[model samples]
Target chain A: MAQKVAILGAGLTKFMRRAKETGKELAFEAARMALEEANMDISEIDCVVMATAPDMFDGVHMKGDWLSDGAGAKRKPYMRSYVGGGSGVFAIIHGWYLVASGLFDTCLVVAEEKMSSCMPHPQGAFNAIYDQFLERPLGVNLLWIFSLEMMRYMHVHKISLETIALVSVKNKRNGLDHPCTQKGIAGEYTVKDILNSEVIAYPVYRLMVSPVTDAAAAIVITSEHEAKRRTDNPIWIEGVGWCLDTSYWTNRDLYYPKYVEYAARMAYDMAGIKDPRKEIHVVEPYDPFAYKELHHLEGLLLADKGEAPKLLEKGFWDRDTKDGIPSCPSGGLLGVGNPIAAAGLMKVIEIYLQLKGEAGKRQVKREVKRGLAQAWGDLMQVGTVVILSK
Target chain B: MPFKEFIEKLSKAKVQKGDIPVWHLYTLGIGGDVFYKGLKEGKIKGAYCEYCNSVILPPRMYCEDCFEKIDKFVDVKGPFIVVAYTELYRDLDDNRLDIPIKVALISVPYAKGGIIHFLNPYQEIENGDIVKPVFNKKRVGSLKDIKYFELKK
Candidate 1:
């Protein structure tokens, strides 16, 4: 019913604990790589969509405006999308419409995060994310909220720490193959390592958490005809879905992510897939924490509610396998380091590589046809998904 | 590279810290204003949405699911139960607290939204343990009016 859209090229910089580069510099590096991969100059871009998290993380207000020049939006339409960490894939969804609506033939989507600049730590800014009058006065660390949700899920599903720890081990092991990974926390994190790591909340460990990172990623999406003209192998943007539950996090059941399921359903419906569990072969559901990847997997309906941990135990998503489903084969934010919106975009870029057989060492050992990537954010309220196929 | 590396190329790298003072004002809606004032009177306020048959604490103006206007202010009687609890050993700066802090989300069974705040330092609490608000001697109609939620005797 709409104009067909496909990703022409994708590029990203190394995920770092702290990048020496500024946000715009990071954006330009990624944008240049993307344009180069597409073999199209920046001037050929019709519009720009910048995906970034909060301004507090970068310590710069008016981030979309500041990133314009670097993103090559010097005189073109520039836009920004922020839904906490979900902005990355959400930006791609916005770009898909720009092309699918017949508005523009080519759209440049770039997501950048400079979290190191936030003094004290990036976690400090999150305190403001709660109610200023009520929840903030309690002086809660953000981990407490995750722990609350984790505990609720554990109680309902009777999930064990070891089962959850497998996600950390798998993603970190996968990270060893990613060239642009953050060095420190990127290697040799096993289930034992996760269990032995510092426990922030009883169910959550430091090693199980994705690091605060500074990085950026960019992807060029164009009309299907333009994509075929530009590249020999084009990854079609098959579907997109983004949904936000109410901001009242306390009111909802934290044990499940209904919003994520809603987003995935929308994408699957648009892509004409009746069942995600069988139709989709590859999955990358956001992994800011080990449990989150599993949580989002259930939300994506790749597994039934509370069944993702069991799937992990069965090696259903073995990253090295040729027959099993693979999730976060790019190492994910768990190993690559999470730069908020950029990490989500990195997942989009990962699927692009997987579908094009350009993922190099990080590529899954399988006959890849279609894949799903999703990012969750905003106190567990927002879910954004993008599906791509060769 | 750390900030020390900037010393070698001062002109090329300008590291700016966000220390400037900024102030923000929020106008509490009718629901919030009523809830805060009710706290001063040693009362917990909630709203009932008949369409959803759900009660929300720290009352909101509209129902999240049904989108119905909430005009019914109900007193949320508690002894609320602890839904979840966590021990945070350090603050955001990674500083070890002299004594670890215990926090939880206390919920009145009838209400959908509960209070996320500190648990009583003196009480031993667990999930589903009933807790009551220990109000401050002086009330400013703030969330802090309740010192902490204590394990109900």
Candidate 2:
């Protein structure tokens, strides 16, 4: 049997449009802060795992090798793992196996991105991720594909744009309390603001999308025995799961995220969760776009397909609502800024903090014992999930 | 399947060639900004790593050896030593050039890493020979500002 694993500490850098720090420096800052919070030193770590999105974004090849020293891996065992945007949450799953399998006692996981390095715009880097022979020939960017997904979802569910816009208003409002939220991205905004915002690709408004950002986030995880010896407030990693759908997204129905459902089912099975809607208290689902929150919520089985927007209108996903499950209380990618891989890890860190009662103003109203953080990416095919409990 | 049939089937498959239509605008990060700006001023600079007791060329924000933050940058006046040299008869696109271009990995004195730049075609160069950078008259904050390196008198 495998030993249990637990998160010891977490750290995050402020999300911004452009950062003066290089990718290495950003990784170092987050790693140093996480070590400090864990009351540990570089020498105490047994291994390190790094996660970052495409090399095109940073304009560097083999960026993981370049960032090894900054992540405190110096001479220790180190490796990089990636599944595009899903890398952040997947990093935690990777670290869990390192300690759970008794291969290492402690692991430091870091996710960083400098999307601003991709000149003109970071969206261009996303263009290169498409299928070369088929998708690339169509000259499709991220917004175009997401617009298709959003349109399909709304059409099948018969959801109004107003209901979808509410996700943007709620998440951005929730982000006002996040110290690391990107400037100008988070604040109180009305649904009308999101509806009237510049339409990048019909149905996908500017205000509804997460901004391009540069940032890093890190967490320290250890074997349950080591965690018990280190801190009294260790958050256990109850379950972890990930899945990837076929790369030919054109063949699939965009109305639902079956990949997320498959991943969530695997995790819920491992955690012995029979009823996610009632058992899971808080969730931080990937919400790079407003409609994605609802799309993912349905995929995670927290709501019936097309039922998430209805839950949102009832104030069920608000941060302060006692009778509701708070979603994206950390402002999510919509308000917190999306630096690809780091955005997913930020969600994991939020769940860790909320469980420990360390989330200053971002904590939910109801008592929470278990929470889930999920990330989706790679042509909208991959889903990574990590379940944490106090 | 027979060899002729397999070849015929393969020939019938369609192949498409395309390019990634994206341009990058990279920010010269913390240390790179200092190093590149110094080049524009007709100077060479390297970041000082106190723990490693060495200066690293192409200055970076952190020392790879000691893994410590590097905050000090010092001028590097060098009789650069040629570590290696290569002559290319073709350009990047594989087109024949009018004259072969000589490139060398030139190491600075007391610095950990070195810069690779064009070696003056007119000068006779060999490994371990001393050289110095000849700056461009109209300097830009780019690697191109260093026109080439010539043999030291």
| RMSD of each candidate relative to the true structure | 24.0, 2.7
Global local distance difference test of model 2: 0.91
lDDT of each: 0.85, 0.91
| Candidate 1 residue lDDT tens string, A87-145 | 99999999999999998999999999888877667787776677665676676777888
Q: Give a tens-digit lDDT track for model 1, residues B1-153.
A: 557543566687654333222232223445677788888988888888998798887686555445335678888888699999999999999999987888898888778888787898767788999988888889988888888888778
Name the top TM-score candidate. Answer: 2
Candidate 1's error at A25, in angstroms? 0.2
Q: Where does candidate 1 stray beyond 4 Å?
A: B1-153
| Candidate 2's TM-score | 0.92
Give the poorly placed runs of model 2, Cα more than 4 Å off: B1-11, B95-100
Q: Estimate each model's TM-score.
A: 0.72, 0.92
- Top candidate, metric lDDT: 2
Residue A225, model 1: Cα distance from true site in angstroms: 2.1
Q: For residue A2, give model 1's deviation from the true position in Å.
A: 1.2
- Model 1 reproduces a share of the real contacts of 0.00
